[model samples]
Target chain A: MRALVVEDYHPLRAAIAQALRGEGFAVDESGDGEEGAWFARGTPFDIIILDLGLPKLDGLEVLRQMRARGDQAHVLIVTARDRVEDRCAGLDAGADDYLVKPFAVPELLSRVRALLRRAYARKDPVLRIADLAIDTATHRVQRGSQDIELSQREYTLLEFLALRAGELVTREDIRSHLYDFRSESGSNVIDVYIGYLRKKIERDDLPRLLTTRRGHGYILGPA
Target chain B: MRSLRWRIALAGGALAALMVLAGGAGLAFYLQHTGEQRLRVLAASQLQALAHGLEFEHGGIELHSLPESGLGWALYKHDGSLLAGSAWPGMAPPGSKLAAPAVTRITTPEGQAGMLASGWFQPDEDDRTGGGEISASLVFSTADIDREQTGLLLSCLAVSVLTASLAALLLAAVLRHMLRPHTDLAEKIAALEPQCRGQRISTATLPAELVPVAERINGLCDRLEQSYQLAATFHAAAAHELRNPLAGLRATIEVAAGPGGDPASALATCHQIVRRMEARVANLLLAARLDAGQVEVRRDEVDVNDLLVQAWEAQATRAADRGLEALWDLQGSGIASADPEAVRMLLANLIDNAISHADRPGAVRLQATTTDSWVTVEITNPSSLDGERAARLVERGRRGASTSSDARHAGLGMGVCCGLAELLKGRFSVSADGRELRAVLTLPEAAEFTYW
Candidate 1:
């Protein structure tokens, strides 16, 4: 998954982006509301963290523009404005969730998790494809009662593919979800990470679950 | 019904009563004098009538004016002997010789108080009395004079009391009518709120007599409104100031303690925020001291050149980071009897402001000049602000830009520098011509004194 953080305070923005990246979500960042709004229009993000006290434009204005443009990314309000009225206004302004500042990192992460879950309509944190199992909560994979370890990049590729196990996810879709605004990735890196994921999860003894369709995209299923 | 109204009425009633009483006394005195003169003249006329009716040739000089009007008359010689007498019922003639025309209080036959007159009057050459005296003294009782005087005085007092009461009532009514505006003004004042911008004492609608009072009240309210606005602004600014660093602090702690966070970066942020907060708190303390009027001026010999170098060194990195060059043209080594801390703060503030607003790759120039009487320091930087902004830059909470979005000094540097300069007997000024902003601090040179 990919998430964007739009906050003015540098340390807070950096910390949120770092925590999201640690959680296997590629995070794009904007230091101000204007840039944040522009990023929202240009990028396809699954979730967005917004701060109200942003320079150039307000977070609410950015949210308004995003909604006006029909961008359906789950927006979580992370602001210093803790007033109940501000919370109500943010929610009314199409905010998916509201989190006041000085919030615990785990709480923010859980809220983001909840929002993403609601967005994708995935009730379970663990995805299953026949004999292969991937816990989306902790990025742990197991196949036929055998625990498997994967690198951060390889694990992200697997999670993205497993979330849409029955459907075909194109290379562009995989690339958009794998890398953030800060990182520009070519097609070869995605293919290389998919190769690494195949080696780890698709054992010769078991039925191959992670497979690729010719001239289409990669899919995670027993095919 | 108010005490003020009652007091006014009481004062008016007292003055009115005094005036009425004085007028009544004057009228009574004049009436009494006129009555006494009329009685004296009537007495003389009666004496003449008595002399005219006297028949001295027979029956021992009959007095035709006696028993005629209840007037008692007697003709006495020089030895107190009655030459001729005519007495009314129970009326007695005086047995003393008459010296001159005299009017005295005497008792009539009815025991009533009356005016009596006795004098020597020339009678007709015909038979008047048995004596060959050149003048026959006549005495007569005054009739009805006392009753008439008492009646006149009583009437004057009655009219005075009635008129005074009416005048007092009229005065009370007029006073009530005249003070209506004052009462209305009081009500308006009672409803006024000094903090409200709309509430004001209506000087234009007030009476002319109290226009000045209303104007003063309005002026006081205006001052109060201004102070209230300033206090509100200060309160908001203080909150923002506190919240800014608090946000940074919380974020730093969260970032350091959170998973996959960089401790080094958080440590740096914490240090930076701590330093900025300390500076802000110190400035607030100084402002409090300034407000309390407890600023003690230190008479210390300060090296301006050293202070300037330190301030320049502190700001040079920021200037260079923004691709700006900080250049110092040290014309002279300025020295003065100044507070070292104040001088250092002033230099730091000026240089920091210059560096913060300097265009990227532009030049920030500092110049110091010392004369026999003054030590001047000037710092100039490329700026986009107009001359008007530069002029008011020294005002508290005033910044180079119109908005608070700029991350420069947070609007606490130049204003405090100006205040400190003033406390050190220095003149601080800013000059901007759109292209360049220059701040000048001209401080008086103190006499060299070594008490250490």
Candidate 2:
């Protein structure tokens, strides 16, 4: 994936560049906001990483110019200001995402991967890991050669866990993801749904991919 | 004369009043004495005429050209013969030979009268005692004395009233002129506004008494203008520096931790970043607010025990993580009027300092006490310094420096604490016990203090 990095600080900018490169992204860089805006307006990229404070022109103006010129590449705003108004203004100005500074490298790579994957709009989107395929486009689950008939909610629960494979997914995360909300169910509904997904998608002999991290939260990863 | 500017007017007027009264009284007295002398001379001349013109024939004496308006004369001979002439009512005629010259009061058939008499008797300047013949004269002239006294009284009253009025007018004009500079200064001060901070109070061409006051006012305005600009610059720079990083971090977390990503490590890292971001934002906001003079603290009487417990809730987790024991000994209850937000900020800073710097397992103590006049809260902790060195830690806080090894924790130095203390209408100081550092906060007792 290709991304544009707009920042003035040389060390921080280089760090972001190296992190993006490790994540397999072709990155174009600009130190000044005016040049960055021009480059973004003329080219097509997978995502645009724009800093708020830039020399010669402000970062908001750059975003406005890019949006005005009809460029819809995913624009993520980067700023040191963790204020509510700044975030709201950036998003309202056509920024697809807003991030505060000094972020971990893995987190940045993950967000870039998510944005790229979303832009693709997978037809017949399915989440698969270790021989289990939960087809979102078809609302069906298949374990090896077995065609599992499952309810819509059980399929959603299995799909949410299979999306992030090999990491602990909290019950809160699973409940929220399956229902598109924080759970109103008696807090053990996630355990019941996981039981259903276990019965439908995994063999009684297979190792589990969904796990729990006590007291902290949850994870969806390899056993 | 009652006006302060009319010093001379009042003094001169009083002196003038004294002089006028004394002069009027002296003139009245002199007129009375001179009038008596003139009346005596007239009486003597009348007696001489009476002695020369009298016709002592048989048993009567006849006198002419008498000027007879309440004037009467009588003659008495040494031979016990009485002679009277002229008819004027309310008059007295003397009997017997006069022993000496006199002015005496006499009683007549009508009323009391003044008679000026000359004891001169003559008989053709030859036989003055013929047939015991004697001549005596008495005159009545008391009405003139009454008129002269009335005129003197009227003149004195007129002079006194005129002097007082003149004194009042003179006093008013001089007082207004002397106070002119102060009035002008007041008008200039009223015209000044915050936008006119660059404008200076000019003392040139003003009274010498007003120059120092004007200079001080100008110096104050200059400092205010500089400080206002400094605050503006700080806010602008802090905002500009923090905007991009925070935006980037928020976007990264929302996408990375939401769905379809490694959740365990990502959430942990995101939480840490959020905590730091929250601290930095809070500190930056506070500094900007202090510089701008924007926050109006709502001062109210807060129970120190209640406030200490509330502050501890926010810092308890951090304290536990650092292995420091946090405790409060709130004794006798006392009230202190303070801004709750500022007090919270101050106590958090103090407790945080203790948690970061004190040795592992070291104890932090917050104690509250009140005398009759003042309520004090003392927060003490274990430290490496003693006595004077501990005292210097407080001075360093007031002066915007760190005196501890854990100074970098939370971005709040002692200077911020000092600033917060001032905002709360209180004082922040430090003391020590041997090797332990103790910070003290003393405020006026809320029950006794009055707010403007």
Candidate 3:
């Protein structure tokens, strides 16, 4: 899948593109709102991320055109304004979701997935990789033919890893997904959880679907 | 009617009433005393003239000169005999005539007097002329007395009444003039408005006694102007700083969710980041609004319980989506005095903060109580003592700190919540349990207390 990033600031835009590439999405970039609007209208995009404050054509206008042209592509609006009126205005301007800037990479990837899945009409809401399966509807997990009974917290951890499957999820990405958890959560908690999941799934009989990426988070996919 | 003006007017009116009464009473007493003294002097001199003209001849006492017109007299002898000369005309005895004359006092119709002439009789038994039994004695007519006394009293009372009325009018005019400056100053003060921050109380030509007071008012205005300027600057800077993070977050989401993307993976990541950024932004803006005191509270009759249910609905989805649990113990239809929008925002911020900070798989408790005059809502979540300190850090985050500094606790969430509470004119308190955090907000009951 491909995505478009519209931002005026160079450093911040580059950082965003780097984060998206790391998440395994092909990223197309625009420095201003006018060019961003042209790219959005001329090219078919799977998702369009917009900045509210942009040079030339404003980000809100770009969003308006995308919706006006019957482009049903998933649109996420990102802005520095967290005011109630600002949020209302963006949603009114045809944005599917709103994001504030300076966010962790994992958060960006998660919202991207929720929007894309609804757009493409994925039948199995639960994600499957080899012998491991994650049920999004019931918050359930299964390894091979056996049902794996995990704690609510352990389920949340596994869901984050399963969302990306083969991609290298970082420690920061895992931390960001654990919204209810704190930055002070122990550094090895992820490694320990991965160990617990391997034992519970009886990895010997099932194919090894969960693998650690050294300093990064565990990946749930065949290498 | 309850203000200082009414109070001062009442006091002035009472003073005027007292002055009118005292002046009227004093004037009456002075006129009566002077009138009595003047009447007595006139009557006594008349008797003196009658006594000086007495003459005895041929066995009878008679007046040598013509009797005074409009005067009448009667004489009594020691033998209880009565005599009257032709001058005695049709005189009657006065009510205040002396019963026995000597150097005696009397208050006749003629007015108060001291009679000086003796009352005696000379009989014809000495055989001077034909035995006619003639007798003589001094007499002063009391008729002249009445006319002269009445005239004196009427004149004196007329003068006294006129003088007293004039005095009262003068007194009132002076008092009202003395009070004019104070009343004028009071009116100016009452008319002052908050928007008139630059106004200086002009007592430049006022009475010397009010100069210091006017100077103090001017000094206060100066302070108010400085504070207002600072607050405006803070608001502008805060808005500018907040937009940076917002722009960056949207840019990342647009690219990841576009064409060459793993639509599933990129969209999921974008949702998480947006939710987190929204939380931070909401809190910061709330603080700025609170600091500026710009929250417009459109007050309405609101059910606290209903407001809570709505707030919980917004938050419950997010918490469930994150694998968290929520519980509530709400009072049924608790009525409160509040702005509905303000109350909802208050509830939303607190609940969202709790859902984000509460322990995973742990329960968040929301409880509400309503009293006759106030309603209170409290939210309890998993927390520790360290969390309490961290919460304090968040509360103070937006005030006078370097935003560029990488401080973990100095994000916008708690600061905005604190600001919102102030703007709503409600009370907010945060405390930590052994392993939980609690936030409580108290608002007035609209049925009992009004916003103003």
Q: Using Cα atoms with residue i matched to residue i, what is each candidate's TM-score against the true structure?
A: 0.70, 0.40, 0.39
**Pairwise DockQ winner, candidates 1 and 3:** 1
lDDT of 2 at B417: 64
**Model 2 regions lying over 4 Å from their true place:** A1-223, B1-70, B73-124, B127-137, B142-145, B148-152, B190-200, B223-452
Error of 1 at B108 (Å): 4.7
**TM-score of chain A, every prediction, order shown:** 0.96, 0.56, 0.57
Worst 10 residues of 1 chain B by lDDT: B399-408
Clashes of each: 1, 43, 50
- Candidate with top DockQ is 1
lDDT of 3 by residue, A38-125 (tens): 8777655667778776644667778888888888778888666566877888999899999876565557767877786676455567
User: Which tens-of-lDDT digit does each residue in B1-452 have in candidate 1?
Assistant: 55677899999999998999899999999999898888777766665555566665553565554635444566655455666655443333444436555555667666656555555644446644544443333444454667778988999999999999999999999989988898888888788874758677767777788888888888888888866765654554454455656766776677578666788878887886776677667765665465445777886777787789888887566577667876778765577778888888778778877876664468888888988778898899887657876776677655322232332353556677778888998898888888898899988765664434
Off by over 4 Å in 3: A120-124, A127-223, B1-30, B45-230, B242-452
CA error at residue B229 for candidate 3, angstroms: 5.5
**Residue lDDT tens for model 3, B240-353:** 444454444455555555545454554555565566557556655656556556667676777778778788787687778656777889874477777787677677777777
> If both were scored by DockQ, which would come out higher, candidate 1 or candidate 2?
1
Best by TM-score: 1
Could you give the CAPRI-style class of model 3? Answer: incorrect
* Clash pairs for candidate 1: B323-B361
Name the lDDT value of residue B382 in candidate 2: 72
Q: Poorest 10 consecutive residues of model 3 chain A by lDDT?
A: A176-185
Could you tell me how far off, in angstroms, the CA of residue A122 lies in candidate 2 after the best superposition?
26
